[model samples]
Target chain A: MIRRDLVFEIGRTLIAIALALLLGFVIVLLVSEEPFNAFINFVAGPLTTTRRIGNWIEATIPLIFTGLAVCIAFQAGQFNIGAEGQLFFGAVTATIVALTFQLPMYLHVLVALLGAMVGGAIAGAIPGIMKARWGANELVSSLMLNYVFYRLGLYLINYHYRDSSAGAMVSYRLPETSWLQQFWPPTRVHWGLWVALAAILFSYLFLYRTRWGYALRMTGLNKDFAAYAGISVSAVIIYSQVISGAIAGLAGAADVLGLYRRFQWQQLPGYGFDGIIIAILARNHPLGVPIAALFLAYVRSGASIMSRMSDVSAEMVAIIQGIMILLVTAQAFLAKWRHRSVVREAKKHGLNA
Target chain B: MGSTLKGIFSVGFGYSMLRVTTPILFAALGAVVSEKAGAVNIGLEGLMLISGVTGVIVSAWTQSAWLGLLAGLVLAVLFALFMGYFHIKLGTDMVLAGIAMNVIASGGTVFALFVASGDRGISSSLASKVLPTVELPLINKIPVIGPILSGHNVLTYFALLAVVGVWYFLYRTPLGLRLRAVGESPDSADSVGISVSKMRFLALGISGFLAGFGGCHLSMGYVSWFSRDMTAGRGFIGLAASALGGVHPIGTAIASLFFGFADALSNYMQSLSIPSEFVQMIPYLATVAALGVFARRQMSRERKGKKQAGREVA
Candidate 1:
C-alpha cells in the first residue's frame, strides 16, 4: 500500500508538471505573436545566464523557508494557514530592529533576524493557542489573521516608518552593517541561502531522528491511536505551529536583509502562499522543500524572462501553477498506475493472487 | 465626545454597513449552502475576483450592467463547476483545489485585464456600466428609518431576497434534505439511494451562482471598475460568517452585517486620527472571536453528549 501510494504521488506530480507546461505553451502560442521564441525563452531562459540562475537560487531561499514552515505544520496535521501573516509580522519586526537600534554588524543582523522569528512565532501562536484551548479551527483563524497582520504592518510602515523621500509608502533604510553579504556577486543571492540550507537540514533531522517528530507524525497519521498511546496531540500541534511560524519569520527576515534595503511592500509578499504549492510538491517532506522550491523558482524565473522578452504576461504562469497543484492533488489522476504498483508489490511479497 | 458618538451612530453609518454587507451576504450564503452539502468551497475569494473583472468587462462591452451581471454570474458558476469537477469528480482535495482556484483567479483575472484593457492595475479604461440604485417604491416616502433603508443598489435588495430564497430552499425542498443528508454522512446518504456527488455538484453550482452575483455586485453595483485583488478578503469573511452563524442563512446574514459594520466603520474611521489598518483588522478579528466562541460552545456540547452517552452505557 505504501509503495503504491508513493508511486502514484510521483507519477501524478510528473504528469501534472507536464500538463502545466504544455498548457502554458498553448497559452503562449495563443497570445504572444512570437510564440516559438516565447516558449523557448520560458523553457531555457534562466539556465542561459549565470545571473538568472543566481536570482532563481535567491528566490528559492525564501520559498524553501516558507515551504519548510508549511511542511512542518502540515505533517503534524495542522493547517496553520497564517504563515502569510506571520511572515508579514516577521518583516515588520525585522524592520523595527534594523531601524531602531545600533549594534555590531553581525550582532545587529542576528538580532534583527531573531526579532523577525519572534514576531512570526507570536503571530503564529495566536491561532495555535486558540485551537489548543477552544478547538477553534486553525484554517479560518489563521486565514483571517493574515489580513490583520498585513494591515497592521502596512499601517506601521506607512505611518511611522515612512521614508518621505521615497515618494511611496516605504520604510526608512536599514543600516548598511545589518545588510546580508551577497554570496553571488552579480546576483542578489546572499547569506540567506546558507541559512535556508541549514534550516532545511534541521527540519529533516528534527522530523526523522527526534522523538517529538515521531510523536507528531504518529498524531498526524492517527489522532485516536496517538491519544490512546498517551501523546499530547495538542502540544504537538502547538509546537509544530510555533516552529512553522519561526520558519516563516526567517523567510521574511531573508526578504528584508537579502533582497531589499528597506521594507517596500505595498501588499503581502506572496511567498507564504507560494509555500503552499511548494509544501504540497514536497509531499510534506522537509528535505523535499528546497528541491520543490528550486523547480518552482526556475519556472518563475523563466516566466519572468518570457514576459520581458516576448508579449506574454508573467501572470499567465499562475495558471500553470494552479493547474499543476490541482492535477497533482487529484486522487483519480494516476489511479491505474497506483493499482499496478500495488499488484507488483503483492507479487514481490509472493502472496497468492 | 457626544458628537463623536453621534457621528459613529449616524444613519449614514447604518446605510454604509448595509452596502458593505451586500457582497458578503451573497458570498456567505454560497458558503453556507456548499458547506451544508459536505463540500466547503474556500475558493469564493477567487470566484469573486473572476466575477468582479468579468462583470466589469462584460458590462463595458455590452453597455448594460444587467447583462454584465449575467455574464459574471455565468462565468462564476463555470468556475464553481470547475471546482466541483476537480474536487468531487476528479478527487482533488477540496481545500487545496480551492486554494489553487484562488491563485488561478488572482492571476487569470489580471491576464484577462491586460488583454482587454491593456492595464494590469485597474480596469479604469473600460467605460463599464454601473448598476443603479433604486428608491424603495413605498418605503422612500416614509420617515427617517425609511430613507435609511431606501434608495439602495438593486442588488442589495436582491441580497436580502436571496436570504429568504436560501432559507426556503433549505427547509422546504426535498433536494435540500438530500443535500444536507450527504453533508451529515455521505455513506448514509448513498445507502439511502441518494447520489452524493450529484447533490454536491448542484450545491456547488448554486453556490457558484451566488458567489458570482456577489462578485458582480462589487464591480458593477459598487464601483463599476475592476481592480486586481479588489475582492480583498471578503470572500473568506463570507466563509467565516457561514461558520460563525452555523450555516443558517439568517444567522450568516447577521454575521455578515457585523463584519460589514466593521468595514464601514473602518472607512469612516480612516478620516479620524486612528489608523485605518487597525480598523481594517476588525472583521478578521471578529472572525477569530466568533470562531473561539463557536469552538468553546461546540466542545462543551460534545463533552455533555459524551457524558450522557457514558451514563446510558453504564
Candidate 2:
C-alpha cells in the first residue's frame, strides 16, 4: 500500500513537471528567436558530450548529501535550514586542514573530510540546541546564521590564508596530494560521486532500517504521542540536526576536494535551499533523493547549454522549478481526480454493500 | 580606539546610518504588518529584487522616478496576491510556497533584466532617474544634529513617517484588531464573523507595497541604477530585524536603525587596518544574539504564567 502511494506521488510530480515545462516553453516561444532549438537544448544538451555529462554529474554530487540532510531534519519535524551555512563552514575547516598539515595522500584526504564534518556538525548544532532549549524558531535563526558564517569564512580566507600574489580574496592553492582522484581521464568526474552514492545508501538504511529511525519518524508524525511513548523529543531534534549537518558538511568537503584547488566562495552557494526542494519532491524519502538531485542537476546543466547555444536565458529553468514547486505542494490541487480514482477502486473491490 | 569611536560618532556617520537604515526600515515595517496577518513572507529578498529591477527600468524608460516606484509597487502587490492564492486558497505549505516565490523572483528578475537591457551584470546603459534627496531649508541651519538629519533621501523621512502610519494602521483601526486576532488565533477570528482570508489578503497587499518602497529606495534613491542582486541580503536582514523588534512598528524601526548603524560602521572602517569582513558580520551576529535572548525571555515568561495559573487552581 505504501508502494502504491509512492507511485501515485511520483505520477503527480511528473504531471507538475510537465505543466511547468509547458509554461517554460510558452515563455521561450515569446522571447527566443528559435524556440524549438532552445527547447531542445534545454532538454537534451547535457548528455550530448562526455565532458558535459561529467559536469552535470559533478554538479549533482553536492545536492545528494544536502538532500539527505534536509530529509533527516524534515523527518524529525525540524525545519533547520542551517545546512546551507553548514556546507560553507565545512569547506572552511576542510580547506584549513588541507593546507595546514602535511601527510600521506590518503590520510590527508581523510583528515580533511573528518575536520569538515565535525565543523559543520558543531555549527549546525547551534540552532538545534537553541531550538531545543529555548524554543527559538529554527527557520529565522538558521537564515540569520548563514550570513554570519559567510562573513567568518571571508575573514578567515582573506586574512589568515591570503596568497597575496593571487590578487583575489581566495585561499592559497591546496596540496596536490589532497585532491580526490579522477577515474576517467580529462572528464573531471572524480571518486566523490561514488562517495555521494554511498552516503545516500547509508542514509536510506539508517532512516528505514534502524530503531533510531523509527523514533525519528514517530517524533515527526506526532511529537506529543512520541513523547508519551517514552521518546526524548528534545534529544531527537538535536541529534537529527547534527546528523543532517554532518552529511551536508561531508558533501561540501568532498566537492571542494574533488573539484577545486582552493576555497573561493564568498557566500552561500544556495545548494542547501535546493536541497529543501529536492527533499520535498522526493517525499522526504532518502532513497528518492539521488534521482531528484540528478534531475535538478540535469535541468541546470541543460539550461546553461540552452543559454549558450540559443537566445533563451537559463532562468527558463527557474521558472519551471518555481511553477513545479508551487503546483506540486498545493494540497487542494488534483483532489477531484484523486477522489474519482479512490471511488473507482472501492467499486472494483465491491465494498460498497 | 578613541579615534575609531570618534569616527563612529561623527555627524557624517549619523547621516550615513540614516541613509542606510531607510530600506531596512521600510521592509521591516512591511514584515510587521504581514506577520500580524498570520503569514510571514520569507521571500522578501525576492520581492525586493524583482521590484528593484522593475523600478529602475520603468524609471529609466519613463524618465520619471515616481512612475518607476509605482510600477515596482504594482509588481510586488501582484506577486503577493499570487502567494495569497496558493497559500490561502490551495492549502499549500506557506514556507515552501514562499521559497518557490523567492527563487522565481531571483531568477525571473535576472532573466527580465537580460531581455530588457541585454546585459546580465548591470543597467548602466539606461539613464534612470533618482529619487530626490530633500534638504530641510530651515532645519539645515541648525548644528550637528541638523546636518545629520537634513539632506537625506526623501524616502528616509517617508520611512520615518511610515512607522507612525503603520502604527496607526495596526493599533488604531478596526481592521487592525481583526488582523491581530487572525494572527493570534485564526479559529477565534473566524468565530467572531471575520473573514480570515480577506484580512490576510489586505495585510499582504499593504506589506507588499511597503516592501516595494524599500526596493525603490535601493535602485531609485541609493544609486539610480540597478545592479544584479542590488538588494543582496537586505531583505533577509530586514526580516531578522522585524523578528528582533517583537513585530511592532516602532520596535522594528529601532532595530532597523541599529542594523543601519552597524552597516554604516562597517563601511566607515574600510580605510582602517581591521578587516571589513568581521565588521560586516555585526548585524547578523546581533540578530542571532537578540533572538536568543528574546526566546529565553519568552520561555521564562511562559513558565511564570503557567505557575501563576496553577497556584490559582490550587
Candidate 3:
C-alpha cells in the first residue's frame, strides 16, 4: 500500500513537471527569436561546464535547508511564511557572531550557526505564538514580519556593521576563522553541504521517529481529530514553526559563511519563498526535499545560463514554477487516471486473495 | 520639534495620506468582498500588479487613460475568473493557487514590460497618461479643509464612494445576501438552490474589479509611469485591514486609514533625521503588532460570548 502511494505521488509530480516544462517551451517559442537555442541552453547548459555544475550544487544547499523548513511547517498545517524574515534575521545574527567572536575555526562556525538558529527561532516564535495563542492569521503576520526584519536588518547593517571602505550598504567581512572550508576546489561549495545532509537526515528522523512528529502529523491531518486524540495542538503549532524557523535560519548562516567573504546581501535572500515550491514538489517529506531541491536548482541554474546565452530572461523559470505548483496541487488534474489505477490495483489484489 | 509638528499638521500631509490610502482602501474593499463569499483572495497583490502594469502599457499604446483603466479592469476580472476556475472547478487549494498567481504575476508583468519597452526596471520610455485630479467647486474655496479634501485624483473619490457602495451592497442587496449565505454555509446555500460556485466567482470578480482600480491608481495617479513592484505590500496590508475590520466595509475602511496613517508617518519620518530603513519598517511592524492586538481582542470576546451562552444554557 505504501509503495503504491509512493508511485502515485512520484507519477503526479513527474507529469506536472513535464507539462510545466512543455508550456515553458511554448512560451519560449512565442517570445524568443532563437527559441531552439534558448530552450536547449535552459535544459542542458548546466552540464556543459564543471563550474556551472558547481553553481547548481551551491544553489541546491540553501534550497534543501529551506525545503526542509517549509516541509516541517506545512506538515504541521501552518502557513508560516515568515521563513523569509527568519532567514534574514538569522543571517544577521550569524554575521554578528562571525564578526565579533574570537574562537577556533570550527567552534566559531558552530557558535555562529547556533546564534542564527536562536535568532530564527525567536523570529518564528512571534507569529507562531500569535496564531497558537490568539488565533491570528499566520500567513499575513509572517509576511508583515518579513518586511519588518528585512528593513531592520538593513538598518543594522547600515549603521553598526557597515564596511565604510566597501562600495555598497553592506556589512564588514567575516573573520578568517569563521569561513566554512570549501570541500570542492573548483566550486565554492563548502562544509555546508555536509550540514545540509545532516539537516535532511535529522529532519527525517525527527518527523518519522519522534512523538512530537507524530503529534505534528496528526495536527496537520486533522486539527479537531488531533485535539480529541489528546495532542496539545497549540504546542505542536508553536514548536513546529520554531523548528522550521531554526532550519531556515541555519540555511541563512550556511549560505553566508559558505559562499561570501563579506555580508553583501542588500535585500532579502528569496530562498524562503523558493522553499515553498520545493516543499510542495517534495510532498512535504524531508527525504524528498533534497531531490526536489536538486531539480529546482538545476532548472534555475539552467535558466540563468539560458539568459546569458539567448534572448529569453531567467524569469521564465518563475512561470514554470508557478504553473507546476498549480498543476501539481490541483486535485482534479489527473484524478480520473489515479482513480482507475487504484481500482485496477484493488481488483488485482482481490483476485489474488 | 517645530518641523515635525509642521509636517504632521499640514494639509499636504493629509492629502498625501489620502493619496497613499487609495490603493490600500481599494484592496481592503476587494478583500472584504471576497472574504464575505468565503473565499480569501490572497492574489490581490498580484492582481494589483497585473492591472497596474496593464494600465501603464494600454494607456501608453492607446494614448488614453480611460481606455487603459478599462483594459486593466477587464484583464484583472479575467484573471480572477481563471483563478475561480482553478480553485472552484479544479479543486486546487485557494491559498496555493493565490500564491501561484502571485508568482505568475510577478514574473509575467516584468516579461511583458520588457517586451513592450526596452527597460526592465521602469516604464519611463512610455508616455503614459495620468488620471486627472478633481477640485471640488465649493470645497476648493474652503481654508485648510479645501486643500486636504479637494483637488485629488479622480480615483480617490471613487475609492471613498466605493466604501459606501460596498457597505450598501453587502447589507441591502439580495445578491449580497446570497453571497453571504454561500460563504456562511455553502451546503445550506446549495440546498436552497443558490449556486455557491457562482456566488464565489462573483465575489472574486468584484474583488478583481476593486483591486483593478487600486492598480490603475498606482500607475496612473500615484505615479506617472509604472515601476516594478510599485504596489509593494499594499495588497497584503489591505488584506490585514479587511481582517482587522472584521470583514465589514466601514470597519475595513477605518483599518485601512490606520495603516495609511502608519505609512504616512513612515514617509514623514524620513525628514526627521531617523534612518530611512527604520522609518520604512514602521508600517510593516505596525501590521504585525496590530494583527496581534486585534486577534487577542477577538479571541477574548469570543471566550466571553461562549461563557454567556453556556450560562444561559445552564
Candidate rank order under lDDT? 3, 1, 2
Worst 10 residues of 1 chain B by lDDT: B1-10
lDDT of each: 0.89, 0.87, 0.90
Q: Pick the candidate with the highest lDDT.
A: 3
Candidate 2: segments with Cα more than 4 A from true spot? A347-353
lDDT at B280 for candidate 1?
79
The digit string of per-residue lDDT tens for model 1 on A1-353 reads 67756766776788889999899888888877899988888889999988998888888988999999999989888877888999998999999988998999899989898889998999888898899888998988999899889988898888989999988788999997778779778988998888898999999999999999999899889888999999998898888889899999999999898889799888888888899999989899987798899999999999889888988878889899999999988888878776777788779888654
Candidate 1: residue A46 lDDT (0-100): 93
Q: What residue runs in model 3 are displaced by over 4 Å at the alpha carbon? A: A348-353, B301-314
Model 3 CA lDDT for position A116? 86
RMSD value for candidate 3:
2.0
Model 3 preserves the real interface contacts to a fraction of 0.75
Q: What does candidate 2's lDDT look like per residue over B1-314, in tens digits? A: 67778999899999999999999998898788889988988777778877899998898889999899999999988887788788999987778877888888878887888888887757878788898999999899899989999998888999999999999989999999999889999999999999999998888788888889998999989887888678888888889989989999988999999999889999878888888888888888888888889999999999999999999999
| Deviation from native of the Cα of residue B146 in model 3, angstroms | 1.5
TM-score-wise, the better of 1 and 2 is: 2
Q: What does candidate 2's lDDT look like per residue over A183-280, in tens digits? A: 77667888778878888988888888998888999999999999999999989888888889888887778777888868888768888889998998
Backbone clash tally (model 1): 0
| Candidate with best TM-score | 2
| Better-scoring candidate (DockQ), 2 or 3 | 2
Q: TM-scores for all candidates?
A: 0.96, 0.97, 0.96
Candidate 3 residue B227 Cα shift, in angstroms, is 2.4
